[model samples]
Target: MNRPTLTRVLVANRGEIACRVMRTAKAMGMTTVAVHSTIDRDARHSREADIRVDLGGSKASESYLNIDKIIAAALSSGAQAIHPGYGFLSENAGFARAIEQAGLIFLGPPASAIDAMGSKSAAKALMETAGVPLVPGYHGEAQDADTFRAAAERIGYPVLLKATAGGGGKGMKVVERESELAEALASAQREAQSSFGDSRMLVEKYVLQPRHVEIQVFADQHGHCLYLNERDCSIQRRHQKVVEEAPAPGLTPALRQAMGESAVRAAQAIGYVGAGTVEFLLDARGEFFFMEMNTRLQVEHPVTEAITGLDLVAWQIRVAQGEPLPLTQAQVPLNGHAIEVRLYAEDPDNEFLPATGTLALYRESNPGPGKRVDSGVAEGDSVSPFYDPMLGKLIAWGEDREQARLRLLSMLDEFAVGGVRTNLAFLRRIIGHPAFAKAELDTGFIPRHQAELLPPPTPLPEAFWQQAAQAWVRTQPDQGLWTSGNGLRLGLPAETVLHLRSRDQHQVVHALAATDGQGIRQGETVYVRWEGEVHGVSLFDPIAQADASHTTQGGLTAPMNGSIVRVMVQAGQSVEAGTALVVLEAMKMEHSIRAPAAGVVKGVTCQEGEMVSEGSVLVEME
Candidate 1:
């Protein structure tokens, strides 16, 4: 077969994955084109591309998921290929066919291969023919709630409801009891319809204490396939992977071989090409079952690349060009351990609800040697609620698992994002947890250590106050009636006291100016290193700020950034404490806003389908 020339490739997606793909393609000397939504014209990925085309819509359906827009962008840019960097349209078999029909190379698997693995029901049946072990479940044609509920009963309690066409943990729910079956089924179906355009579902016997291990498989058109070891994605929240590492810890060599060979067999049966992942659920008995196959590069692919010293995206391009696999299965090396954690815009104290705001302060960890940060947004960019809330990924590699874990923790400490809530602290707690340090792995790792992971309020040290005071003192004019007299009672010439705010709490501390070291300045804030720890302090006008930390009981407000999906009560309606009032949907998940106390609804401030900011009042009660 003649190799296809990929002079230029259009990335038909947005955010970090697009940035990730562009980095490798540019390094390989290929022209890259980025197709962005209406709101993403100023995005980092668009600016990083050799050429960028506007997709002309803010939402996914009208832009990223629109096959015609992406195709037109590629053709207009004179690109010969399209790289659907995971998420939006990466796994869509129809999009792959459209690319092929346009005589353009799709830098992914063939449409046939995607079709074979797209649907859970069909994929499970196909795996049976391929002699691959699968989890016990009902992957039949019946799509009614009654049928699914009955199937769950047959599978016993704790059945998992999953969207047949869903990935990235969307449209998936765990029904722990019969009473929870109906609501879970409806929610899963609604999410499936919203996300995948298909509401068909499948029921599975939920495995207990299972480790999520997935094999990275690569294939070429000329009949070659290989597995690049395995990644342990067991540490998860809301069914989405949080921490991923290569060469799953505690896996015996024999078990690794068994899983890898099984993954290869599964790929061969589908005539797979390019990069793909076969996920599995492994139990305590060393038994494994096929979960699902992601027919595109995974979000956690960097960990696999870090361990193998190979670029999977480059391989995808080469394979799409009809080239042969670079190496055989025997040559695949798992040199060292690597770990990656997703950095999301979320509030851990508020149930990890997604947060969106202007990144007023953002500074990434410095990358050198084994530390890598793949991001799509820089400081001053807006994190909109229209897409995924992930800021980026932080990955670190070391000689061993412990080294990698410790190195990643240090790197995370160096990372900072402000003007919005983030899960950075939560990630630190997880990696530093005792069980995590001991390599005690399972799917329920997060919930198992939830108590230890939540932050307990601790008072700021005196050095932190000194750090803030130094920065604030420098910003102030030397001699002024208002500024010079901003101290405590009976204060002498040398007496200095500063009132400040840290993480939304008011602080009054005594801090004298220190003429020691320099502090790093970010925006209007200063980050100072004290006692071997970095502390960030920003000056705020006392008159402009309202102290709401103590008085949080006036009206029900939006807990995070989201749109009002539903309003359960009306104005003048009577409601008791804990009564549900409104539903907010953010990051593709729904959360109810309930009444704080028994009262009459004075008014409903927010209506359905309206976007609300964090802390925006939604309902007022009296």
Candidate 2:
């Protein structure tokens, strides 16, 4: 086979991954083309590309996932290849075939390799045949409710249901008993269909106290394959990785070699080409079970690159041009420690539900050696409800694990965002926790330390209020006695009594001329950065509060912009305090609205399949 001359490439995805790929492609002297949905026309990725193609829709299904449109864009833009950056259609075999059939290179593994590992059930069977150890479970063809129930019983209590065609924890659920199997299965199936266009599922025994460790594998058409060390993605929430680090801590040389060899074998068995990841669940006894293979560059691939000082994206492009592997397994380098944490527009206090709003204020930590920020949004950019809520990622590298961890913490502190709720403070607390510093890690890390990590909300500190008031006063245009409400009297000291509101709490802070604090005033709200946390402070107006319309005592509103997927309760339905009333799908995940207290449903304001905005009333109860 002759090597294809690549001069231009098209990125058939959006967000940070798109930008990340374009950066490398451009550095290699290739003109980069970027495709975007209607909502992402002004997105950071779209603006950075050498050429842009508008796919003309807001939703992923209508734009990013539309195979025909993407192929047409690549051809029209004269791109020699298409890079599906890790999600959307990255793992779709048909997309790969389309690119090949269109006479354009697909910068990923072959279609056959994707097919072999596309379905969880099929992948498990292939691994079994390859003599790789697997967890005990049912990966059969049957998909009926009775079959799943029986399989759950056979697998014993506590089983995990996973979408056959899913990754990134999109269509996954854990059933602790027979009673939860049906609903969990239904929900998981719906998510799978919405996400991957496939609802086939597989059931397996849910492993407890397991560490999610995955090996990075690279291959070429020349039959050369190598493993680029491993990453421990044990810190997670909602089955999705929150933190990942390269060269898992406490892993012996023997264990690392064994796992790396197995991963390489798995890739070679399927004739995988380009960048891929083979995931495993490591138990306390040094035993590991095969999980699944991600057939494209992983979100955490930066950590691998940090340790090896190799660009995996560059390797993918080189492999697509019929080149040999850059390095052999024996030559793979394992340098220093590297850690990455995902920064998302989400509310950690609210079950980590995705938040959508403009990036009113956005600032990244100062860039230097060992510190990198991969992001696709900038200040004034709006994060819509149609896609993933990840704003970007923060990565740090150092000569040792402690150094790396501490650098990542400093990066997190310097990072700041506003206009939408985020998990910035939540991430800081996690990394600063003594347990995490001691290298205690597992898939259940978040839940296990929920008491410390997800503690109940407390009142704002007095110092914060003082800082807020000071910042507010400094931003005021006038300080004159007549123009400013500084309570200036002819004979007494001047002081300003400001009624401020932060979230649901109100405080009257007196401001005597104190030094100003760091803050930004957007409209009537002052976003103050105090003690490494951002607090939004607004002036409280009693008149407006009295005139505002109020909802019923038990009204349940949509948490964010989303489509109602299911309405579990109807008018006049009496429900317990925790009964689910509605389920909203946003950012490719579902969030349920439950009854706040035991009450009777007075009305169902929103019907199934209705689009709603944040704070839109969904269910009214009495």
Q: How many backbone clashes does candidate 1 have?
A: 0
**Residue pairs in steric clash, candidate 2?**
none
Q: Which has the greatest lDDT? A: 2
Model 1 vs truth, CA RMSD: 3.4
Tens-digit per-residue lDDT, 169-260, candidate 1: 88899889988788678778877765667788999999888999999999998999999999999999989899999989999999999999
Superposed model 1: Cα runs more than 4 Å off: 458-463, 474-493, 516-519, 527-536, 540-554, 571-580, 596-602
lDDT of each: 0.85, 0.90
Question: Model 2, range 3-25, lDDT digits (tens) per residue?
Answer: 76799999999999999999999
Estimate candidate 1's alpha-carbon lDDT, on a 0 to 1 scale: 0.85
